[model samples]
Target chain A: MAPMRIDQLTPGTVAHIVAIDLDELGERRLREHGLDEGVEVELLHRAAFGADPLAVRVGNACVAMRRSQAAGVTVRVAQRLEAAE
Target chain B: MSEVMTAPVVALVGNPNAGKTSLFNALTGARQKVANYPGVTVERKAGTLTLPDGSRAELIDLPGAHSLEPRSPDEEVTRDVLVGAYAHERVPDAIIAVVDATNLASQLRFVLELKALGRPMVVALNMMDLAERDGFFIDYEALARELALPVIPTVAVRRRGLEAVIAAARDALNAAEISAIRSADAPAMLVEAIGDMRGHQRQARDIAAKVVSGGDANQMTRQIDRLVLHPVSGPVLLAVILFLMFQAVFAWATPFADAIEGAIGWAQGIVMTSLPAGPVRGFLTEGLLGGVGAVIVFLPQIVILFAFILVLEQSGYMTRAAFLMDRLMAGVGLSGRAFIPLLSSFACAIPGIMATRSIADPKDRLTTILIAPLMTCSARLPVYAVIIAAFIPDRTVGGLANMQGLVLFGLYAFGVVGALAAAWVLRLTVTKGAGGGFLMEMPKYQLPAIRDLAIGIWQRAWAFLRRAGTIILVSTMVLWVFASYPKAPDGVSQVDYSIAGRIGAGLEVVFAPIGFNKEISIALVPGMAAREVAVAALGTVYAIDADDEELLEVELADRLRGAWPLPTALAFLAWFVFAPQCISTFAVTRRETNGWRWPIFMFSYLFVMAYLGAGATYWISKWALGG
Candidate 1:
C-alpha cells in the first residue's frame, strides 16, 4: 500500500522503485545498474551474516548491495509471490 | 584501396559481463597485448583483428563500464576514449557497442547512452545462444532500424557471427566520414546524457517493449542462488570452495613446482661443471640461476591460483564469494571486494596487489595493497620450513598434530592475524576516509571457457616471469657481487671477508637487540631479492660444503641447531612473517600506485612490524624457556 525501503521488503515480494534517497554518486550507480523509478524489483536473497547486504532482482539482473545502500531506495510493493515452502 | 594504410581502430565497448572480453579474445585470438594505460594502473588491452576483406583493424577492449559517466578510474578511461578525450589512446574510427541479447531492455540502456556520441557504431547483440536457450526471440532487423545501427546476434564464446560482426564494423568504418559530419551536432553529448539517464532508460524500455518477446531468463541462476546463497549452506559452500582452491593451489601445484625447481637446479649443475670456478661461474650459478630461479619456482603456484580465480570470476561465483565475505571484511573497514585480493596474497603478493584494481574505492584498494604482503606468501614457505625444521621438535602435540606442523600452521595463522590487525589500524589512520560500500552485480553463471582461462593464466605468469628477469635478476646479481668480492685471506672465512659479510657485520649491531646473529644479518641482505633466498644465503654463511640437496638440508639443519638458540630461530620465523623483503613487490606497488609514496609507506610500516614482531618473539621465548 505504501512505499517501503527495499531492505525492508520480504523475500519473494515484488515492488517498483518509487524514488532513491542516496547521495548523488550512490543514486547514479544504482540507476546505472538498472535501478530507477518505476522499475520492477524482487527481493531475492540476503547475505548470511547479519543480513546486512541484500540481493535484489532488478529487471532480469541481480544486484547485491549492503543494507545501507538499499535503504536509500524507496519502493512500492506490487505483489507477493507464493512461497514454495 | 590497394595502397597500404594504417589500420583503422575499432573499439569494443560494453557493460561488465556483456561478453565483450570473450568477443575480443575470439576475434583477436593470441594477438592480444595487455599493458597499463600511461599514468594509470588501468590496463590497456588491444589486439589486431582481421576484417572479412582481408584488411586489419586494431581492436581495443575498453574497460567495461555501465555508462559514460565516469565513476571510477576505469570508467573515466572508457568515457574518455569514447569521447575522443584520452590523449594516449587513438579515437576509434568505429565503435562496437556490446550488449547482452538476453536482457536487452536493461543493457540497451547503455547502448542508448553510447548512441548519443554518434560515432559510427554497430550493436553486437552478444550471448544470443543464451537468449535463445532462455526462450527469447528478437526482430534483429527491427532492433537495428530502431537504433539506426547494425545489430548482429553473436555467441562470442563459440565464435558465432564473428565474420558478420567484423564485416559490419568495416562498413561502419567506411561510413565514418559521414558519421563524423553527423557528430558535428552531437558535441558534448556525454554531458547531456549524464544528467538524463532516466530519459535513456525510458527510450530503451520503449524500444524493448516494442520489439521483444521472451520467457523469464536467468531462472537457472536464481535456482542455483537459492542453495548457493542459503543462510547456512551459502557460507559453508563458500568455505568449502575456498578451502579446495587453496588445497589445489598448494597440493596440485607441488609436483609442477618441483619440476621447475629441478630444471633450474639441473641448469645450475651444468654451469657449475662447465665453467671454471671464478667470478663468471659464481655469477652464473649464484646470481642468474639462484636469484631468478627461486622466483620462477613459484610460477606453478601462481598459475594454479589464477586458474581458480579466473574460473570463479568467469563463472560469476567470485561476486557471490565477495558477497558472502562482505560483512566479515567490513569489520576491518574493507568491503568484500578485498577478499579475493587478500586470498591471492597467500600465493604471491604481486598478483594480489595487482588484483586490487577491482576495488573502486581508492582508500579501500590502498588499505588492501598495504596489508597484502602480510599474508605469508609462498616465498616465505621455504624460510619457515627451514627455521621450523631447525628448532621445533618432531614430537607430536595434543597427541595428533606434529609439533613442527603446528608451528608452521601457527605461522600462517599469525600472518593472517597480523594482516587483519594492520588493515584495521591502517583504515583508522593512513587510508582512513569514507568507508567503501559493497555494490556489485551478480551475473548469471556459465561454465568458464578453456581458452579464456589459458589466456588469463598465461598473461599473469608472463608478467611475473618478466619481473624475475628484470628486477629480481638485477638485485640478485648485485647481492652476488657483494657476497663474492675480495676473497677471504688464507684463514678468514670467505663470507666474513666479503662486502656483504662486512655489511652484515655492521648490521649485526643494529640487529643484535633483536637477537639476530651475524649470519642472519648477512642473509637479510640477499633476502631483499626474495624471501626464500635467505635460506640459500644462510647455507653459504654457515659454510656447509654439502653439494647434494638432501645432504645440504640435513647438515644445515644440524648446524643451525648447534649454532643458534631456540629463541633466535623463532625470531627468524617471526621476522619473515612481517618483513617487506621482496623488491618485486615494491616495484609492482610503485607501478600500481603510480609513485614511490605508497611503497615507501608500506616498507616503513612493515619494517616496524617485523622489528617488533621478532623482538617480542625472541624475548618471550627466552624468558619463558629460561634460555
Candidate 2:
C-alpha cells in the first residue's frame, strides 16, 4: 500500500495504517496511543476550519489526528466493486 | 575518626523518556510529594533514601530536560536546579544524570553537557535492557573513562541494577579532588561531539549486552504495533478502551461506592442515637459526617479512575493517544503540546496546570492552562456521579453501551468541546498570532511495570486523602458555623433562617432562570472552592430536612426530583461543565502563568460560558420536557 494524504480518505473508505514516520518521541507516542499498524481505519469527519484535523474511526473508537502525523501513516484504499459489474 | 560527616543529596535529572521518575520512585518508595521549586512553576519531587550504612540521603527529581540551556519552564527548572540558581533549594551534592541507554546517541549530548557542570555526578544508563535488545553493546568502562564519571546500568522500572547505582553514588560522594570538566558554551558543540562519538556507540553501551537481551520482545512489539498503529483499527480500539474505562468507573465502583454510603449512614445513626440534642450532636452529624463523609463516599470511583489512568500512563500508551490527537488539537488553534497537560486534567487541574511547562510557547501554555479546568476532573466525579445516578435512567444505549458510561463520556466530550471553543474564541479575541510549532518525543511501547504503577496510584490516593483530611476539614468547619447559628423563628427549622439557607435563597433568584433551587445554588458557591465540596454542601443542607439519615445521593436526588425538575438537574450538570474553575485552579494558573491577566481572562470567559450554557440547557430541557 502506498502512502496517501489524510485528505484522500473518505467517511466509508477502509484502509490499513502502514507506518508512522515520527521521530523517536513521535514513534514512542504513536505506540503509546495504540496506533502502530495492521489496524483497519476509516475517516469519520474532518474539521471545517483552519488546519483541519481528520476525525478517524479505528475499530469502534474515533480520534482526531493532525495532518503532519497522519502523513506518516501509509494506507491502501479498500476497493469496493459491484458483484456483477 | 571522630569527624563530622554529612550525607550527600542526589538529584535525578533526565529527558522525559529517561525513566527518571521510575528511578525516583524506586529509590524513595512512598515518601515523596510533588511540589514546585520556589519562584518557578516546574514540579520538584524530592524524597529521602536511607543508605545501607544508616546514612539518610535526600533524592530530588527535577523536571525533564533535553539540554542544560532552557526553552520551556520545565527545562528551565532542570537548568536552574543544576546550576544552583532555583529559589527553593541549592544544587544537590551530586547529580544523577539519567539517560535512556537505548537512545544514548541522542540522549548523551545532555549527559555530556551535565558532566561539564563539574558537579560530583554519576551516569545512570537507564533502560539498558532495551538498548541491548536493539543490538547496542555499551562498554561502561570506556564511557566512564570518556566522561570521567561513574557509569551504572539501571533498569529503573524493574528495580534492577539499583545496587550498582547506589554504589556508584557512594563512590562519587566519597571521592576527593575530582577533576573539573570544561563546560560547553554552545549546544552545537555538545551536539557535534555527540555525533562524533556515535562510532564508539557499540563500545559505550553499558552492561554485558547479552545479559540484558530481548530478541523476541522486539519482534512482538513490532507485531503489536501493526494493529495498534493501524489507520483502520487504532481509533476504534482507543474508543473501546476509553469506553471500557468509563464503564468500569460506573459498573465496578457502584457496589463499593454504595458500601461506603451505607457505612456513613450507619455511623451517622450511631452518633444521632448516642448524643443528646446539642451543638456537639449537630457538629458530629452535620459538620463532620455530613460534610466529610459525603465526599469520602466517592473515593471508590476516584480510585477506579486513577487505576485506569495509572495503567495507561505506566504502559506508555498515553503518548500515542497524544500523538493521535495532536492534529485535532492543532485544528482548534491549540498546539499538540497541550495533549499531556490536558490529559492530566482528567485526574486534576493542579498537575495539569503544572504540566503546561512542557509547552514552550507562552500563548499556548496560557491557553492550555486556562482551559484545563474545563476538562472534567476526578473531583467532579462525585458531583457528576451523584447527579447522573439520581437523574439519568440506568439503561443501555445503542443496545451494547451502558447509558451511564455514555453520559460520563458525554460529559468528558462536552469539556473537550468547550475547551476548544474557548481556545478558538480566545485566539480570535485575546491572543491573536501564530505561535509555536508542535514537537513531542514518543517513547517505545512497554508493558506497565506493576510496582511503578502501584506506586503512582498510591501517591495519587494519598494526595487525595491528604486534601480530604486538611482543606476539606477546615472548609467544612467554617461552613458548619455558617449553617448552624441564628435560630429560625418558633415552629421553623433553624436551617431555613441559617446564613447558608438565606444566601442560597438569595442566589436562587439569579439562578432560577436556569432552574436551580436554593439548595443547588448554595452548593455551587462552595463548589467553586473544589468540585467535591458541592456534594458535601448538598448533604449538609439536605440533612436538616430529613427525618432520618439517607444516602446523600439518594436523598439529594429525591429532593431535586420532588422540588425542582429534570430541567434543573440537567442544567446543573451543564453548569458544572463550564463553571469558572475552582479556586485552586486559579491559584495554580496564577503561579503557572506568573500573572493575574490570564487567570482573570479564564475566570471571566468561563463564567460567561457557564451561565449561557446553563441558561440554554434549562430553557431547552424545560421546553422539550414540557416543564
Candidate 3:
C-alpha cells in the first residue's frame, strides 16, 4: 500500500479516487469534473511534455488534470483483474 | 440521401475539465479562434470537417457545463444553443457529449439529460489513458446499452479515438430516431427515477467493472507534493516563478526588440532616401513608420509575456496560485470565479469581461467586469516600457534582482491593487447583494502537451499583430494629419501651430494643474484607443521633423523633462493606473453587460478616480522634490 504520485499511474491500472486536496476553487473544479468518492479511474497517458497534466479515463470519457492536484487524489489499487489470455 | 447538399452541424458539450477542448483542438486542428478568452469559452466555435463523401460537417464546440439545468449565464447559453432557443441559429444536427472516462457516474447524469433531449448524440469517453492508469474498466457496450447512445473512447491530446467519435456522430445523425423530446408526461417521474437510481450506484460500477481496466497510483507525485505544497514553500515557489516571469520579459526580449527596431529603422531610411521630400515622405516616415514601429518594437515583450503565462497555465500551477489567492480576492468583494477572468485581463480586458459569464451572481459578474480593465494588459506594456526606460534607474536590488524588473512588477502590482480597490468600492456603492460564494474544481495535475501549448502562444501573438496592423494603423495616420496640419508662421515652430498642438495647448489649461504639458495632453487623447498607442502617437508627434538616429527613448525623455516637471511624469503614470481611457474596453464592457448604463458608470467613475489619483501623485511628488 505504498502512496504513489498520480503521474506514475500507468495505463491498465485500476484505483479508487480517494480525495482531492485542493483549494475551494480546485475542489469545485474536481467535483465539476466528476472526481469524487466511490469513482474509479484509469490513467490513460501522460501528456507529451514532462509536465504533470495527464489524461485519465473516468466514466465514459477521458479528462486531463495537473499532477499537483492529482497528487492530492489518494487512491487504492483495484483488486479485480481480467485473467491473462 | 443528398449528403453533399448541406453540412451537418455537430455540437460539442461536456462538463468542465472533460477534455472537450483537447478533443475540439484534435478535431479542428489549427482552425480554432478561442471565441472568447483564455480559461473560459462562452461562444460556440465552428469548424468544418470534409467528410469522406466530400460533404462538409461543421463542428461546433459549445461552452462546458455541469448540467443542462443551466445555473450560470455560460450554462444557460449552452442550454439555449442545445434547445435551439437562440434567435439566429438552428439546433445542431448531432451532439458530441464528451465525458471523462474515469468520472463516468456524474458525467453520465449529463449524458442522460442529453439523451432526454432526443438529439442524435454520441459520448466521447475522453482521457482513457488516465482511466486505465487508475485501474477503472468501462464496459462501453453495457454503458451504451444503459444510456442508449454510442460511446467511444478517446485520448484527445494523443488524437486517439477521434475517428470513432466522428463515426458515432455520423451514425447518430443518419438515424431518424434522433428527435426533440416532446413527451407531455411530466419530468417529475424522470427526476424521481434518477434520484432513486442513485441508490443503485452499482449500475455505473457494474458497467465500469466490465469495460475499464488497469490503473495503479504512481509514487513520484506524492513525494514531490509534500515539499511543493508546504505552506512556507508554496508561496516561496510562487514568488520565484513570478520573479522569473518578469526577468524573462526584460532579459529575453531586449535583443529581439532591438532587432525589430533596427529593421524598422532600415525601412524608414529607405522611405526617406527613395521618396521625394513631400507629404508622402513625412506620412511614411513620421506617421506610418514612427507610429507603427514604436508599437511593433514592443512585440517581443508581448510574446515573452504570453510565453510565461501559457507555460504556467499549461503546467497546472496557475490554478494553484488562484487557489492561494482566493481568500484574499474574497476580501475585496470578488469570488473565486473572478480569479481566472481577472488573470486573463492582464493580457486583454475584452475576453476578461466575457469570462464573467461564469460568475453566477449578476452583481459579482458586473463588479468583476468593471474592475477587469484596471488590470495592466499587454497594450499597457509599451507605455510602461517607455516610461520605465526613460525614468527608472536600472540598478540591481539586493545585489540579485534588477531594479527595473522590480519596478515593472510594481506597476503590475499597482494595477491589481487598483482593481481590488475599485471592486471594494463598487461592492459598497454600485453592485448589489453579497459576492458569490466560491465553488471551483481542481483537476488532477498532468503534463501539458507541448503542441497545444505552442498553439496557444501562437494564437496570442497573432492577435497582438492583427491589432497593431489594423486599429493602430488607421489611428496613427489620422494622428499624423492632425499634428501635421495648420502650418506655423515663418518664425514659429511648425508643431506650435499644428492642429494637435493647438488642441493640446487648449486642453493643457485643464491638465496643467496636474503638470501635463500640451504635448502630453495631446498624446493622452489618443491613449483612449489603447494605452500603447499613446507611445506611438508621442513618437510620431515628437519626431515630426527630426533627422537624427538617436534613441527615441532618450530623446523623448529629454524633451518631456525639459517641457514638464518630474511631477507630471509621475502623475501620468498614476493616471494610467486608473484611467477610464480605453474606448475598446468600454465597447467590450457594453457588449458583455448588454447595456450602456454599466459602461457609462464605469467610464465616469474611473475618469474621476484617474484625475484625483493623478492630482494626488502630482502633489506628493512635487512636495518630495521641493518643486
Lowest-scoring 10 consecutive residues by lDDT in candidate 3 chain B? Answer: B181-190
Q: Can you rank all candidates by TM-score, best first?
A: 1, 3, 2
Candidate 2, lDDT over the whole model: 0.72
Over the true interface, candidate 3 deviates by an RMSD, in Å, of: 10.4
Interface RMSD of each: 1.1, 10.7, 10.4
Per-model TM-score on C-alpha atoms: 0.90, 0.83, 0.83
Q: What tens-digit string does per-residue lDDT give for candidate 3 at B487-568?
A: 6677776667798888889989988887777777888888788888898888877877454454333445555555566788
- Over B208-311, each residue of candidate 1 has an lDDT whose tens digit, in order, gives 87778875858899999999888889999987776666556546767987798789778977887788866687677666776666567767866886788889
Q: List the residue pairs that clash in candidate 1.
A: none
Note the B-chain TM-score for every model.
0.89, 0.91, 0.91
lDDT of each: 0.83, 0.72, 0.73
Error of 2 at A7 (Å): 15
Tens digits of per-residue lDDT for model 1, A7-84: 999998889999999888888888888887888898899987699789999987898899999999999998546645
Better of 2 and 3 by DockQ: 3
